[model samples]
Target: MYESFFGLAREPFSVAPDPRFLYLSKQHRDALGYLNYGLRRAGGFVLLTGEIGAGKTTVWRAFLEQLPPRLDVAYVVNPKMSVQALLKRLCESLQVELPADADRPGAEADLIDALHGHLLLAHAQGRRTLVVVDEAQALALPVLEQLRLLTNLVTNEDKLVQVLLIGQPELRQLLEHPEMAPVAQRIVARFHLQTLSRDETEAYLVHRLTVAGLTGPLPFEDEAIRRIHRLCRGTPRRINVLCDRAMTLAAERGQLRVDRALVDQAASQVFDLPGLRRVGPGQAARWVAGGAAAVLAVFALTRLLPPWQTAGATVAAASTPSTASAPSSPSAPVSAVPASALAATAVPPSPSAGKHVASAASPASPPPVTASAAPLPHGLQPYDSQAEAGDTLASQVFGQHLPESEAWTRLARRWNPAFTPTADPCAELPRQGLRCHSSQGGLGPVRLLDRPGWLLLTGPDGRSTRVLLEGLQGDQARLSLANGRTLTVPLLKIAPWWQGEFHTLWRSPPAYAGDGVLAADGASGTWLAQQLARLDGGPAQDGAEGLALRIRAFQMAQGLRPDGLPGPLTLMRLNHATGVSEPTLAGSAAAR
Candidate 1:
């Protein structure tokens, strides 16, 4: 309903786990890495455990996206089946033929044979095979044991199949059972998926919105984002639900932006807080009567006390002088108090004596004691000012230079966890204190002095170089080079003051300078050329001998045969040292 008003192409906050809408946070990336490692390292089981709606399936989809075409993949979405049935399902997924009357053992054998054949075929074609089982926690022990046994199928060099098991945290506990230890021991890689951080939640929202065709700033306010973070605790599924409800509420009310009130309302409705429900007039009267009785009882008790004690009661009552007046008669109108006022006055203050009341009423007296600071909700750590400063520095760097590259944006995402970018990187990296100058020099070394502080240099050739320096001002800084060109540095690239762990780290080699040192003798003599290339400047002689020396050194460092014949590895290493990728050789049998 609100889509047209906001100019959105579609609802941006659906709870469904659409693969197209998958956003890989840091935790998601780590989980995917574990999955990839497990499958690539054959002869073992890889386990991925996470809480429900933690995006395990999304990571699985991402894994499938990056899989090479040559590899055959079998995915088991449902794992609640008998051993025989499970084997049959695997066969069906792999498209293997089975006999019409095949029983348990028969089906198992046929499936194994088909898998073996496929593995051999894939190997011959320079490929691999992987089997992914989702919700493996539901698999019975017997079925899990069978999975362990399947890892036995292997050649002398490598395993014929790789297995990935993905499920909830219960899966991990299940694997700890004595009966499942054998299977657990076979796991080569494992990662537990976790919820996103507060900043990550914000980024996730913008990413989804942008993907859904949102063109403006995020509809949610900062407080709304924080509220969603608190409510969902960074779980992608919960965040989606909350955001969806908030958007719906905003649209219904004809609001362009979803504010904190809308978010709180949605949360209260969805979570069903009893206190938030409104009471009718009859209920309200009863509540007010009960409150009045309690107050009168306290007042009667105070009246019976000595004058000195009663003075405290009187003072307390005076401190909270009510603007409400008593009804003149039984037929007089009853004043209706606002809910906000009632909420504010629901709790009574402790009684104090007349002396305290006089002090409070004095013109120069201080205000009543109030809470100095609100405690952060559970599970939240206090914000680190240093980290925030560092992020500010890094944001400035990218804001000024390399604004168009996705890699740069990813860097910014890492540096400032709070920034959420849609499709356009332009709006994300604000241009503050950003200045750029073109230089004639090649890419210069990037140094991080402090977070949000950076100095980037680009050579006369227009190739850029990045360095992050600590203690920079604003989100951008400018440096003038010798050739009358200026370089722009974004603050996001700035390194934190404490990140300098290695003051003596080796410098990156100068480009193309290592190309001229090679020796002619071959594998036995390449090491000498490497040492010569490491020397300060170019060799005294710029002849064929000098070039041969550099080549020998490059070949030796790269572990090549080093015949000094300029082989692929030798040229490749030399190119890498010079910051270039060697082109593939054409018409060469070895290259082919």
Candidate 2:
């Protein structure tokens, strides 16, 4: 219905086992290789299995088109029958005529005799007989055992007939049974087809569209493709269903492009889910900013507690009754009074006590504590050298499959929003409930943070590279690149680019409560300017002029208006820029 409306010659998404429409993805190619190997070997069974609608039959049909002339083929589409009925179906597939008047026992014996004779005759004629059973998972144990016994017609060199079993994943389970050991042992080649990757899914759609006679650009947008891949899990059958419905919906609406909304509407109808809509960029920023604020508030509260407590204590002491005001010593601890008596006797300090309060109170003496000097999270080991830290960090991201080794994979899995490989790692960091703090301080400051991070390195050729700083040993630093390369460099041997610009990924707190005061005069402004300086990978500046210049530079870099005033969005970006981990949207979580 959508073909003509979309200016196509044919329907691109017909859910049939059409060999011409087969998209040979990596898994499909591998499966075809396995099937070809079985045919060449010709002495044993070849097993092919996949999830339902994963294109097992389509792959087999593609295989059938390339069959050699020397191979005599018999295709069985249905295998859900008793042994006698199965044998009859097999005979019928081979075009062998059965005896109409024969008894049940006689007919069974005759069928086997004829099949064995027919295979031997084909072998004598320099041809191979191959039987392909579709949905073999439905075949009973007795029927399967009988098929296994048929392989006994083998000659001294090779079997006269080969068998190929194709079914859903259940076929693997059936073959794993102890009773099916003989059948399993004879299988020379096996492959389980998997769904396509996102890239492959996109290509598959285009290929189908081209085959259906589209000469123009693809109708689906990139975001639409992404959503389709996510909702369909890269299953071609489901993708076909969704795309077909989406195309029809688009046609009805007179829309030329198959946009994200129509794709979502089609998916909702097909999958029986609610309609999905893209979150506005502003809304997403708010969520990320909210999370970041929570993180800052947590650390800020911890940092400011001493000052707040000291001030509170000073006020409390000033209000305490003097030795002359009551029959109790002013130095007595509050705990000295019985709980019941204290609760009943507690009263507000009188205005007269205010006269002596200032002279007697000195509780607000301790200095404020900053979180910058706080220790790293537990279990995060610090390195003495930048190179050592980078190597250890690299091993975690690009290393082999080791426990607690695949750092990126672990973070990606834990992140609220599902991340695709194509996503910008830096841009998605905030949505992951984490932030990336970039600093231009030397290895001393980076190491002082005592957290794993990605360090920006500039080569002698002026090419920028990123290395993971995992840990350190003595004076040597462990650094690793995305390509699985590692280096152990002494602190003194660090590169010029190692001028200390690095980004760290870390967790956010459970909640955030704050005044959101980022750009203020005095100390807070200085702190904010320092953070912006670090995020800019530039020298720390002093006074308002330097702060404004740095803020404008950062705004320009982030593609924001260079107003020099840090607004909510600017503050959000600043927080993310100084955050410990990459942030990604919780779109997947919201969808759920």
Candidate 3:
């Protein structure tokens, strides 16, 4: 309706998946890169997940528009079907002709044979076949198992079919089901597409408007756009819904531009709120009035969202009664609710006790992974009943609480199998082709470093305890304790107690000795120069050419101090950037 008045070719804020309007924000770009990389591989699954309106479907469509010229795609838009129905749909999507007898509902074997034959023919003709599933979280276990079975249809040098699964964050959780292990193991690439940032939110509007043929300045004022970001938390679809309404309101009022007041007015109408505050997805409209204090507490406590190693799918959670008590072991159910749904943190007293934390990520919980090993020492559980009173696992005073040696050993095992429990684990690293790295920072930098590490969580008293942060996804953290027990907890509860100290292990580069300063004329320096060149897209050098300056520049960019030394942490980051083969968090390890 406002297109003519705004001088636009089309509606700028339609909630549709159009490739032209795909804004290449850093997260989007990261996801797109993984999609492109997944397509290049011969076989395996490419899993992409996000919130309902987080632009996952849009990214998948963009991937389609950029499909390899020689690809045969079997796209399943809705995967909530029986295993037989799923197989039939894949056949229909890929144009694989079904036999007359295959019309029977129970002819799954025949359906599989037909699909295998079609894939083989396609492969022989030098074509790649890919199966793409949307809303994959709705898929049944047998359906998922069938998808894994499809991956087994292979010849030498390549599998006959490659699959891409796109769904909400729970799809990530669903894959973690122990029964889904076969399919989980085949995921070659996985990325949790997150919402845009504040800057990207603004740019998203500009890009959409520009694509819709706007030649004039933006219709929404700066304050208006910022307000929209706060309300929508940078979710693209929510941005579209709000902006569409705001523009329509402006157009009706015969105004050329929108302001903060106009945006708030639009939000009130679109979200139907008397006062429009930060409207998180899945949050109730009632929260706009009663949730302010709780929102502030949780927002300020703003827990560490690990680099989407979100359960690195298990990073998800839900609500419970005051009587909820956690199981003594990881094997038993923590609650009727999954671990992802349960907030491990103390709920700061709220005006309405019925409300949950607004900032808490609401990924659907999958079945908790059952640990066959021993439980937390003395039956200490992951979710404590006293957590609401600030007595979480980290805050507990257990008689058999893990000592530093065991913590160091658990941390060491990620890198070195032979690593033993010791007070000085750093001294044991050199002999294991590894190096010890420590740093103090918030979760963002540690996530940027993106290596699993040991977190020193202190209790109410002055004493500290060691916990292994093996997986981090959104707001859920999978922590390993001394007895080899693992459990997922909300980062919200843990963030307040942390004072920013951590230690991780990194593999040193070739010809690099575990020693003091890396000499400029030494082999290590030459290797560092080449790695830097790979990242900087510059020339590789055997001789020093402003090598110290290059190292310092790299350090500063990576949030490290501007020291020229090539420390183990810096090198590990370089390895990550250059796509070196190394162990990642559990969430990303399988995909890598």
- The candidate that wins on TM-score is 1
Winning candidate number (lDDT): 3
In terms of lDDT, the poorest run of 10 residues in model 1 is: 583-592
lDDT of 1: 0.55
TM-score per candidate, chains pooled: 0.55, 0.48, 0.50
lDDT of 3 by residue, 1-592 (tens): 9999989999889998987798766577567767765665668999999998999988888767656568999889888898888888988988889878876868999999999998888888989898999998999999999888898888977888888999999998899999998899889888997888875787688779978998666788656877899889889999999999999999999999999878888898888664455545444443433344434433343354443333322212221211222212222223432233234323222212213322233455433333222133223334542245544565442313677667767777766666676677778766666677778856645666777788877766666667788876544566775556676665656765577787777776667667745666677777877887775544577456467656655654454555667766667767887887555663434211
| Count of backbone collisions in candidate 1 | 52
- Model 2 TM: 0.48
lDDT of each: 0.55, 0.64, 0.70
Per-candidate Cα RMSD to the true structure, in Å, reads 16.1, 26.6, 19.9
Q: In model 1, which runs have C-alpha deviations exceeding 4 angstroms?
A: 103-106, 268-592
Segments of candidate 3 deviating more than 4 angstroms: 277-592
- lDDT tens per residue, model 2, 1-592: 7788889998899999898788766477557756765666667789999887789998889778666668888888778877788778777877776767434664778888878887777788888888889999998999889888887678788788789999989999999999999999999888998888876887788778878888666789766888899889988899999999999999999887888778888987788664354456876676566545544544454456675453444334334544323233233444432222222333423222322343343454332221121123222223322234345533333343222224343334434346554235545655544544455655433433445566655555455556666555334455555555455544444544466675655443323112232444576566665676564444554677667656655554343456777654466556555763433221112211
